[model samples]
Target: MAPIELKELKDQLQELLERGFIRLSVSPWGAQVLFVKKKDGSMRLCIDYRELNKITIRNCYPLPRIDDLFDQLQGAMHFFKIDLRSGYNQLRVKEQDISKTAFRTRYGHYEFLVMPFGLTNAPAEKLYAKFSMCEFWLSSVAFLGHIVSAEGITMDPAKVEAITKWPRMTSVTEVRSFLGLAGYYRRFVKVSHVWPYP
Candidate 1:
């Protein structure tokens, strides 16, 4: 992380404590925070919960399809995305399970009073009640690895560029990841042979 990023993260941690989202943790287990650049060029804080997730059982729930979601929104006139900030943090973790979400920052060790990210069933457990499966209507919205808008659904140009410049896959996991990306936009190449699908 850059010096600026380090400062921003410290400020973010202080804010999280002030906001009562986290508390000084004395837990034996701890996770590290991962920062990533968002689309708007702002730093987004995330926790790497790979070790914890490996031991947790997954919820066998199916998320609704993007195409099916769009089909429902076909005739709607008004469109605006419901933007929630620190969405996962809005939900409280069980008192006993709070220790599981404890994380370490450069500043200090802290545990989440609210739900933390990277839990296998976190989204389903927290946001499931308020969840609505609807396709986003925007100038250009990334939907399921593809871009969609009023002009119609299309492959994201970045993904196309990656596909063209991408190296040959050596491992099964790499092949699956590559094929999974191509599979979404395969309709564009095989059916329409064009940029946007009608």
Candidate 2:
């Protein structure tokens, strides 16, 4: 880590500890921690839980599908987006399972007393809770990479711009990847039964 990132990491660790989200642990299980750069040039701490997730039993609670969410938004006059801060940290981890969330840092080994991101069950756990702070939109609101409004759902402009500016494909793999991304908005586009190649 860079000197700045290291300092940020230490600060974040202290903050998390003070907030009662994590505590020092002596668990045999430990994951690695790293910092990712946020869009606004801040470091966001993340833990690599791939090893833990591999052995863990997954909770297959089905989350609301995007199409289903959009269907419910139809004819709405206003919209509000709730952006949760430390959303996962708001949920407590079971006493016995706390050690499973342990991660080691140069500072020390710590385990989350609350849930953390990157866990296989985090999404399912989210369904049980709600958070504070909201942004209200009278006309439209950007949600899950799409815009919802009284006019109905449309692809978010930023995402559409990104798709338009996507790099030229150089291989079959790249072409498939691009198609996979673009295909998400296929519902908004017109399609023809006749094949252009055939």
Instruction: Work out the TM-score per prediction.
Output: 0.70, 0.83
* Local lDDT at 171 for model 2: 81
Worst 10 contiguous positions by lDDT, candidate 2: 124-133
Q: lDDT by residue for model 2 over 1-198, one digit each (tens)?
A: 888878998999999999999999999989999998887898889999999999989877777998898888888998877667667877889999999999999899999999898998775335332344566665788787898888888899998998899997788888777777777788877882433220
Q: What overall lDDT, based on C-alpha atoms, would model 2 receive against the true structure?
A: 0.84
**Residue-by-residue lDDT tens digits, candidate 1, 78-116:** 455544556788789899998999888888999889987
Error of 2 at 149 (Å): 0.5
Cα RMSDs, all models: 6.3, 3.3
User: Clashes in candidate 2: how many?
Assistant: 0
TM-score of 2: 0.83
